[model samples]
Target: MDSSDATPAASAPRDPAAPTALRDEADAVLRGLAGETARLREDQWRAVEALVAEHRRVLVVQRTGWGKSAVYFVATALLRARGAGPTVIVSPLLALMRNQIDSAARAGIRARTINSANIDDWDSIQAEVADGLVDVLLVSPERLNNPDFRDTVLPKLAATCGLLVVDEAHCVSDWGHDFRPDYRRLRTLLGDLPGGVPVLATTATANARVTADVAEQLGTGAENTDALVLRGSLDRESLTLGVLQLPDAAHRLAWLDAHLDELPGSGIIYTLTVAAAEEVTAYLRSRGHTVASYSGRTDDAERQAAEADLLANRVKALVATSALGMGFDKGDLGFVVHLGAPQSPIAYYQQIGRAGRAVERADVLLLPGREDEAIWRYFASLGFPPEDQVRRTLDVLASADRPLSTAALEPRVDLRRNRLELMLKVLDVDGAARRVRGGWTATGQPWRYDTERYARVAQARAHEQQAMRDYVATAGCRLEFLRRQLDDEQAVPCGRCDGCAGPRYDAAVDPGALDAARAALGRPGVEVEPRRMWPTGMTEAGVQLKGRIPADEQASTGRALGRLSDIGWGNRLRPVLAADAGDAPVTDDVFNAVVQVLASWGWERRPAGVVTMASRTHGLLIDSLGARLSEVGRLPFLGRIEYAPGAEPAPARSNSAQRLRALAGAFTVPPGLAAAVAAVDGPILLVDDRVDSGWTVTVAARLLRRAGAAEVLPLVLAVEA
Candidate 1:
């Protein structure tokens, strides 16, 4: 287990007895990785041989809890002992990298990571790797596409790497449930690897189609034409799958409160969104259960500590989003309960697979929510933009004299920050653009926008989503159905799921617990952080604004009655705010909730006047909200900010920068409104149906402030958390 041992040279002569000795050594490594009593399965050895002995590309498609990590760790030990260069692993999640490092140490392979979370140590880690003092280097796939790292460090690693491992390899395929553009860039790394260097791709979730795509990518441009795919049965014999249809979010949380004790030892509780995850974790803790929340919003240090808590069984469960999936090792995890269905069956299978790895039996339950489809649709909306949008971005880059940062590009394009960066990574992979020191630049590589291909990908995603819906409603054996969805060869009825064995868990919730859940969730109010800095390239977008917004023009910290993603009010808001839904006047409950939020809010000063944003589709809704506030609070009612008399209404925008640009000219102070605003000796409350990007509110508040309002305080019916 010492870190000082060096790998033998790849060209070293082999003894007749050396193969047996290496196999024996690998067994010892497995024992160390899985504790002293463990042994490798036959399939695990097959994978190890393909990577270390045969020096061939391998793709391992196995069920979760099948010890996929053991295959790589054991092979790394064998390869390092043979004097090969250190193994390089592209992991998708920080949680995965952390688990890998700890597991590698037990197998006597020294491992280090280079990720955004640990910037202070990256220099030292690279120095150690160059000196051959490290055995395994685990990094996120995003790092592979990082401009500096790609231009400087990648070439050397490709040439000298002993083995290349792509964990969660399904991510490389657009057809995969969790496809990431950065993962697709791995093909470039594979193509550039030295001829003799072996590679391995591993995933628990890929179906037959994704397997083919990933395997082809793994074999790309190599001397080898075919990747050695070692596929295994997807059946997890220890899992008892079931689905509980909950009537509402209140009942769902209440069910957990009533039933946490009935489940076995520590496990995971999965929710579809970050808000749901946090809400569920809080409710569970309030009910005296030991649990922690895991999501993208969780800080690195807190996430690490939460992981440790779950691993050590100090907490009963971790309420998490997909952020906690992929390479998290907990063999004895006793259960996995989903608060809502995942968008696809592959994702569901992969999540539930996290349970029942080491134990004889583990519980897997799904409390399918009525609003799950709405959540899924919202996520689906963020998929790759239409061809014209991509072309618009490329045109901007191609026309620009200098590379522009993402922030600068934001104002020139309609894409949001997250999706914009993702598109750039895809372009970088396709050679349409290149990310460099300054930012991103068009490559002028005669790239054709693949509209047909993208369309087909979109179609495939729709099919996956439909498949997930069927999963929740199926009457057949859930395990067998899930296995078939993954194209498992051993797909057959397990006779242990709720469909086959009858409902295994009661669906009822105590009346008291349900009431308490309703009370907790019904409590509303979320703070909206004010926009401090203007987005870059505002001047180029024809808005003269730049740098930090003037202090006087900024709106104060605002409040929304509730988030659209909340487990409570979110259910009530989704239908009304839906794209196709017609506008309806505010309901009594909604009006009361808004009033309650205002009463509880302790602002520095009370508003003396009310102003409303111009509502195209929700005029009645906005007017009613503004009128009610004015009458109840004893404030003067200022006219709404409206479009200029004959000016064209700008089309609806989907991103902040673009929205701000359009709103800059869309609204003006109606003649009487300016004088009414000048009459206001106190802050004016700016009312809106909802606050999405906060750009509309910001622009409107600035106009009112310029007209003579002392201050602007924003209030909205909902916030898109």
Candidate 2:
């Protein structure tokens, strides 16, 4: 939506230099925006006055639904009234940008957003902003580092931009729960702005350290000044907090399925992982609940549609991941149910704040799972790689004669594409690399990898995690516990929490619903889609392969009993494949599960021989699985692909080009394996303990295909999601 239709016609702008005049106009804007008679709270007035009166940087650390948007919308009108340039707000999510745009329109501030969601409209929005018609412009943090935007649009915006607002500002801190390298680029924008331009940063979730870090970063280049920090209690008085410890995922699903209709109003149901969100959404839909799944993996159109559905109360609840966090406005949301605990109490508080915003009381339920800690650790593992990896990445970029794309640099570095891109953005923010037309070019500048700083951040994250664990088990008031975690000095025992009120809700799941949920979770077999195209720049990695993988060389669609994220088999196999897990023969339970998977697989041709990839630690398990499958099917048990002694197989790489390069010549068919494959004269069942990158399976299947196996069918116990 453009600003022209969203806003009201201007009625002669008001004076901004007078604080009293600004206050009167601000209250009018707030009343219009909130859709009721209202006056600004003392803290909000302080923020507005600081921005309009003194033109200083301000950081507002208040809970959600605290009218933080009103302060900015009002400030934008006042600032623009005095002929200042449009307010530039860097939001962290598309859903949030959309909500803010609607909110700004309510206040008669002409607002428009330029994000990945609306690429075709960006030129129009930019044109409108240039013509001084748009009063406020919203963009995602990632846009700040986009190659074209940084080189072309950013300089123009910085030169003419009036007020800067960083929403979800906690992401600026490395220690924050939602730390993103893209948000850190704001320092450059803050530094480039003229001294008198007001800047505001707002967030609902941040501890003292994160608050200080954000405030310090808000006024980055101003040596002698600090941002005006406005901190408020994070307690949500309208929320009735409680926790329900479910025995298993199925039980939790059953509870939701049974009680969803009983919930007061349309709200949100949160899951820890995308898989769980999808799974829960599918199950609830099967039970005839009008729900939608929202996660990072959801398409842009679908995410927008889901948000609209929830806003209009079309769906019962949106089963979502943290992708639904921050800036999702629902004034009368009835409840928020988290299927699993977030890694930090601050994050949990922020998510639940979405509910009960305009209502008297909304239910906030936490269903702690047995697998929550595992999920937390899985995400924690994705933090910044070691100093050596960063140095190596920079060194590779520095030595390149021309700008190199991430695909070309993949083989030279071991980091995954996502992590590598994050590092590149961080380097770009630090001025150590520049994203030019070709791709990325390293600046010939010395950059120190902050070992100690990252270590401290990691330590802080650990403390947050422990705090979340303690939150679930705390005997004190849940509301007070969360507030205390945010360092709210006014935190006290809230009589509305479960602990204080002595369990105000029931924890029971209907017997029939529980049975149905069990049946749903028990049903196994996940389709493992094969890799169709080869990774780009494989030739640069010393593999002669490039371009589309020959159809004959590609592995066919395969099957795994379950994903590593599944609620059913995931819990059982997680320990089996864990880093410290002991290697042993497949248990009867896993073997039976695999047998069921194969029975229902309905492959065009049955496996005539069993082949196993030479395993590093799970050799015993793989051998037993292959041997047992061969015996059961009465097929030949072909020998395993041999790993040359002392030759390291690709060490579980995330980058495809690097993985393919590392797997080159790492596996070879044994003396009799080719003869066995030819004799079988049909599909070969390639057994493995697990499949992650699917590179190992690809390489092994390619070898068997060339060795005369008619077809290759990969069967694994678990597949990493």
Instruction: Please give each candidate's TM-score.
Output: 0.95, 0.95
Summarize candidate 1's per-residue lDDT along 110-156 as a digit string, tens digits.
Answer: 99999989989988999999999999999888898888789788988
Which ten residues in a row are the worst by lDDT in model 1? 1-10
Choose the strongest candidate by TM-score.
1
Give the Cα RMSD of candidate 2.
Answer: 4.9
What are the candidates' C-alpha RMSDs? 4.3, 4.9
Model 2 residue 616 lDDT? 82
Q: List the residue pairs that clash in candidate 2.
A: none
lDDT, model 2, position 407:
87
Q: How many backbone clashes does candidate 1 have?
A: 4
Task: Give the per-residue lDDT of model 2 (tens digit) for 322-349.
Answer: 9988768889999999999999998999
User: How far in Å is the alpha carbon of 468 misplaced in model 1?
Assistant: 1.0
